[model samples]
Target: MGGVIGLDVGGANTKAVWRNGGERRAVSRPFEVWRDREALAAVLREVVAGVAPEPVEAVALTTTAELSDAFRTKREGVGFVLDAAEAALGGPPLFAFTTAGEVVPFAEVRARAPEVAAANWLASALAVAAVHPDALMIDVGSTTADVVPIAAGRVAATGRTDLDRLLAGELVYTGALRTNLAAIAPRVPVRDSSCPVASELFAISADVQLILGHLAPGAYTCATPDGRPATVEFARERVARLVCADAEQMAAEEIDAIAAFLHAEQVRQVEAAVRRVSGRFEVAPPVVPLGAGAFLAREAAEQLGRAVAELPW
Candidate 1:
């Protein structure tokens, strides 16, 4: 069989993996065009054009694009997918956003990969089951963490119910990017006062990750509502913008204090996520961590008191 391309289109980035004649390479680009499908498709076309002289073989795609409440219905979401697929592949790429138990055509595999309703951890489970057959699969990404209970080669679905599903210890809303530190915790201990961090329109989880060296500064983008690329100075400004008050007038100590506050909150959220899953599963957790944010995974493992196994991505 000829090598194919696997694209995982996430909320903050578009990840592309190419298997060209047994050689594998991966690229992740900023998903700044996520809010606008047309622009995203144009970029995808450029990426595809750069890869091959002609259309390669079949293309595979997985997406979290539809999850945005912006599109009210699945039909609209599907339409958006089809549009992008047509732009990149010269036709619709098979979609695979799905749930467990339901079998989909090979063409639809990406879109039909078990969803949160059945077990959002399906992708992580599949990725982990290849190696760790009998362990809790903790797939930590930039925006969320998913811990799935795996036994043998199958993923144990707690049920199809969303509420009960959360009780299964398979979903955590902490990722390597795009999360809000303010959402992680309200008060973070600084040099002095327990600074109560306010949820400003700035300071995404990516900034915290960048400061901790989990993500490179070059990865930062100004893909805010303004659509400009975020510079290092701009990121600092955004990070500073998270304060309840004006950041322009804040002292250097206050800026450091805010960073300290966010760092503390980040750790706390990881700890809370670990505890939430460990208590429910009642089994020794398996830390099968992947994603660009490596530091966060290690910290999460340390806080959770679990063995860490890095995926060879």
Candidate 2:
């Protein structure tokens, strides 16, 4: 038996796992977007060295970044990924994943509909089924949480990936890294009266992750809309600062209030998701949670009155 490689290219970081004779061996450094193509390729080469010096027979790539219109306009982002893939595998069969559950050939991905659910949370959920077989996998990654139902080792697909799908409980958009608290809750208790949240910061569901401990400092990717690293303290400061735009700012009470508000809203969303799948699967489907934001996922499951079987990383 030869070796194989699995590469998950995300918006914030790139992860690679090398497997020799079906046994996992080594991994790579979390490649930040600040690094150039040459640097990323070097990192990949380093990760795959001991397992396979040259290209393997196949390379399965699940890219959440390259498919976004945000990345398409940049031009260099997807191209750089292709460059890295070719450099590593000598261009062997490259499979691009999508929320639709179809493994698209590289040529099709490079030419059309890249902006669709290419490597959406649904795709990650599918990846989980290959191992768990009959468990519901909830992947709460940097930007979204995907709750997928798996039975008989196949991931169920909804054929939809729009924001409405997420709101309707067909998908879970609440993530660890990039969701606005305002979106989570419009009215938050500030002082004696409820104050409407002001939309200003690029803060995401990650704020909830930070408070919940699903994510740590280094786990979060840098790249604030202004293009800087986001420190935990920085996130806290910005969140705290948002409180000041109103009369509630004087007491320094709005920060905690907002955190509490966001946390509750996240719980609401998770409960709604479990309800959506309740008709099809068990009221308790042996939840298998994975991702950078597993801690929050666990809490979300509890909100639905279920227990989680968290995978060991």
Candidate 3:
């Protein structure tokens, strides 16, 4: 193929990587499909154009947006997304990369929608296998982390569907952003005694990461839980509110402590799942991190005593 545009269309964010000969460029855009299902076509066009101003030979896709509750069922969501891709990417032939590693035409994929839905992990794992051969690949996105096990230069994942992946330690439904802090840490340490978090969406992983300095103002892509600025000060305020305290009331050290604890908890969650998945192999492979939250994956991989393999591609 002359130029290939690869897309991982997610519910909250759509990521595209355009590879033309030896040059590769990528772009990410936020698009909540559940809010405006029809806007996907426009997003697809814009995302593609952002990566490649000129037309490409093919559009390859791995979609997780089909899991959005906007559709009654995953089957329906897959068909809708495929339709949008076909319509928006008018001339290029559309191909859907399935969890089984086959690239089927968009038209045929509608019939295999169930298998094609939410196959981003498998797609990534397959790509990793082509490069690293044997690796424990983990992609920590905004709302989820995928732990895929590859062995012998093949996709050795035990799970295919999202449900199966969740059960097989191949999926941890928590990430470096957008995840409710309460879900990761029900209780955080306070100055004097441990305190239970307020069971509200006052803060998210983004806040914890921002407050802890893992994320910058510009990289905090998701909307803050409190609709405030993405600054460290605002992040501190949101994280403090997790314990139902204002930033002024809580010492900066205390808030910092809580953010650190929550960040560790997030890493612990992924690390546990990575251990479970990597342990399945006779010899665990190096960890390859992808996505915006690669920092979190690196932290988790280090805790597991695994090398963080670099992807030259």
Clash totals in order: 19, 4, 0
Candidate 1 deviant stretches above 4 angstroms:
20-22, 49-55, 91-97, 101-103, 106-121, 157-169, 189-191, 221-236, 245-253, 280-282
Summarize candidate 2's per-residue lDDT along 164-262 as a digit string, tens digits: 456556567676666766677777776788777667664566654564455676666534543444555455555554444533344334565666677
Worst 10 residues of 2 by lDDT: 243-252
Between the candidate structures 1 and 3, which one is better when assessed by lDDT? 3
lDDT value for candidate 1? 0.59
Model 3 off-target regions past 4 Å? Answer: none
Off by over 4 Å in 2: 25-55, 71-84, 87-93, 98-117, 120-123, 160-168, 211-214, 224-233, 245-254
Q: Which lDDT values do the candidates have, in the order given?
A: 0.59, 0.62, 0.89
TM per candidate comes to 0.78, 0.75, 0.97
Worst 10 residues of 3 by lDDT: 275-284
Tens digits of per-residue lDDT, candidate 1, 1-313, equal 3466666666566666667664776776776544675676766666555544355565656556555554565456545654676656764234343555342434554353334122334655775787877666656666666656666767765634334545654566766667776777677554467766776656677666565555676665424422434544455566666655444676655665666567666666666656666665556656666655446656767876788776665
Error of 2 at 276 (Å): 1.3
- Pick out the ten consecutive residues of candidate 1 with the lowest summed lDDT: 112-121
Cα lDDT over the full model 2: 0.62
Per-residue lDDT of candidate 3, residues 194-213 (tens digit): 89999899988988888888
